[model samples]
Target: MGCFAFKSKAKNQRAAASGARSPAPTSDGQKSKASSASTPTRSIQELSDERGAQRLRVFDLDELSSATNGFSRALKIGEGGFGSVYRAFFRSAGGGGGGRVVLAVKRLNQRSLQGHKQWLAEVQFLGVLEHPNLVRLVGYCAVDSETSKHRLLVYEFMPNKSLDDHLFNRAHPPLSWRLRLQIMIGAARGLDYLHEGLQEVQVIYRDFKAANVLLDADFKPKLSDFGLAREGPTEGKTHVSTAVVGTHGYAAPDYIETGHLTTKSDVWSFGVVLYEILTGRRSLERSRPAEEQKLLGWVRRHPPESQSFRSIMDPRLGGRYPAAAARQVARLADRCLVKNPKERPAMREVVEELERVLQMEPPTTTAADKDGDRRLPPAKR
Candidate 1:
């Protein structure tokens, strides 16, 4: 499940400050020799076959259970339509010093059809795929001889919570402008990697949204939840046939209407995320009165051309960000929301343009000092 699917303020709060790496408890947890080679370079097909054959080593449920204190309520991180995520600490088989890596364990809901597919897909995809901006696949476990129920997928824990928590939740202070810009760039880079970064062929990430983007302690964005990913036609087939499985507001209109899944579909979702970053709002909203339910539609009606940007600025930001930066973001968002996917900018172009705009951004202000006149180099040294 994507981050939006889960709604836990406490877990989100802890995650907001720290990457998902959990510290090992003081007692009761068993220690095992970390795998000598946790991940060896391998092709996707090879990994997929390996998973089927049980070549992927399984972690003892008892160890994870003990680590999480029997999935104590306090440790329950995030839960979505598919399952609840619990933070756990486990020793690496490779014997690395960072024995306590925060891991997000999704325990699948047995009755959920969508969750079942998502669980397997995540295990398969992350099991093989490796990248920095993308969450790492530590390992996974399925039903077995003794404990043959409850499907679970574990991932490298990220301290900072999902982008949604920072952008929407009020508990945390507003993220600095620099952090926000970096997150956007990191996310775009992650998407760029997914779309074209693979060695053999491209992969299309069908789902892209703020909630799907996790942040580290430094606020670097890491894209997760690839259940809807489809291999590019060059790798397997140019197209795939499956019912749409994305959040409503973020889904590409053409793909939703005609079921044509392509790299452009991901671009459209990216546009929605870009819009969210600029405006600091959910992609879709019904909280407003009935007439204002559709966010994108409302944005189109009150395009940046005709109105003050303040109408869409997040109240929390206090209009503190640069006006030029905001306008540049809004303009790029407009281009991304083009109904014709062909008209939208390519991911590479988006990355390049955002990098340029980020350059124009002023340095971030720190908390320790008053608004002083350091810019004028003193009257006399």
Candidate 2:
């Protein structure tokens, strides 16, 4: 889990001439975060060049620590298997006067397996990724020899917390069916980006659940947490094999059985997310009848076509939602959770399907739009 520094090919020559061995990859077999396409490679002679050293200044640990109050307890916002997340403010590296910028800093706990490797994974994936619904990686921090004792990652702070907090927390108001459907649409868009937008490198997000989907002020979902993601096959390779790593309820059944990961795994997980949105329930519910504890299992046994769909919709919404919209989302979730991953629709299809459903129904926002526009007159020359 220790951090390792990176050196360009040219730097190796000078180091060899100086009788020093090039640093090795971290023990976990994961690549360095700095090796991603976004990092510029420099030669040994270039290390002494102005550009090489200047590039290093993009991350200022001292300033980051200051922003987080030296990673203070009061700043702590959330925690997950990877580590603790703290809220902080980072100044734009461009020397803009320190304006307000909030960030979530996840500092890895020592006990976690693949601790540094996970950091590298997020760095490599998010550094170059740009998408509206995907959480942006503003920057990251590693354990230099001097700072090896601590590891940290920085991300754009989501003003509204994770979807899990709202869905499961009893104190919070039960999310309306309209809002939940919108959240699903937003999450599907994020998944669509990972599956289709990146050329040559297809990514399967290993974790797709309520907690990983954060909400913005407008309640648009931003998918976060690339720690569990894996690069999909290239050039006709059918699949990628890796240890099964994901939450208990969300892992696709086929992936669990074979350890062969594919884009369809994400589709299965999306089904679980959709189910959560529909029911206002967690993927795993122990309080329910023992036979009904597994959300997907329960939903599969009681498919939407069987007239059990009404019971599946969140009771908290008080049946206020349109029936057709509920049926569309239910059918979409059923398609995603099919036992055969091949049968599931791709994320793009899911997005389009949900959008079609939304468009078919009257939008809640349009009521406000209609009311506001009524006060204004038609433009006149």
Candidate 3:
């Protein structure tokens, strides 16, 4: 509930270092906007060398205070162990006459010295990274003055919030089958970039769950939350060894047991989400019957190859989705969930598989039922 709370590492050990790169003021002494690039590392010395932090804009207390009305509870958009996220607005950069800019400001608790590392990690990584599928880090604020010390991160406003919201909240309209697949493909591309995009280093997203996948106004999925992200194994190294910390039921078993993390570990988590989009169930849902409590365990009973598989699809779908495409999604999810990490398909392969499903012929729409639910014929295999 506290947003990917980490348990293994001592809170003190992760405190912010005095020497890590902190936000710098602009030349004109104005600090409203940044380069608009989205880009992480945790070690203070190591992250400082990356120099990605320099690219970000710095926000003064006044700007943050004005935007959130002195961090009012009314403007609070999200809350967790680390801090609260508030929706804020500011005058756009360049000219005083510029339009208003919508943003989300994450104001970390001052007492959470333990979480300053995570805040810095996000600043380091988001500063250098840029991608359509990765949430953009607009700016940051870090102050250690006498009165108060502030650490805040500014991000482009995600009007649609997160995939977790749309998937689990019954209040929201059910996502169409086509839109679901599209969101998955886009998220896969974001993960693929982290795994294979950087020339010198790869990012292993330690936490890959529905909640971390934020959506823009268009429902475009973008990966967020770099608090637990770690650099992938260097050349010749099999995997990075670190304390396992991720949301329960979403972590890869091998990583949980061995503290060894690889891109494949992310692949496994991605598989869990693959099933999530298909079934509209969290990785671990306890509200169902005893046999259906755990998503993976319950899904195994009805393999994609079996006739019972359709039973696991989100009932909210009302049989409107293409039957064959749905089955293929289940099959792909299984591939991502392979017990052997080495055997899991790469994110690129996962994206390709999903794309192929989208290319398949549309399911023929037949007559609507008495309730007006249109029955869709199974897609061609």
TM-score of every candidate relative to the true structure: 0.78, 0.79, 0.83
What is the TM-score of candidate 3?
0.83
Q: What Cα-based lDDT does every candidate model obtain? A: 0.65, 0.69, 0.74
The TM-score between candidate 2 and the true structure equals 0.79
Q: By TM-score, is 2 or 3 better? A: 3
Better of 1 and 3 by TM-score: 3
| Tens-place lDDT digits, model 3, residues 59-173 | 6767788999999999999886679999998987766677888899998887785577778668766766678899998777665555656778899999888889989999987
How well does candidate 2 score on lDDT at residue 217?
A: 60
Q: Number of clashing pairs, model 3? A: 5
Q: Which of candidates 1 and 3 is the stronger one according to lDDT?
A: 3
lDDT over C-alpha atoms for residue 157 of model 2: 85
> Which structure among the candidates has the greatest lDDT?
3
Model 3, runs deviating above 4 Å: 1-54, 94-98, 111-113, 146-148, 361-381
Q: Model 1 Cα displacement at 192 (Å)? A: 0.6
Ranking of all predicted structures according to TM-score, beginning with the best and ending with the worst: 3, 2, 1
Off by over 4 Å in 2: 1-58, 91-99, 145-148, 363-381
lDDT of 1 by residue, 241-270 (tens): 446768889999888888877677888888
lDDT of 1 at 294: 71
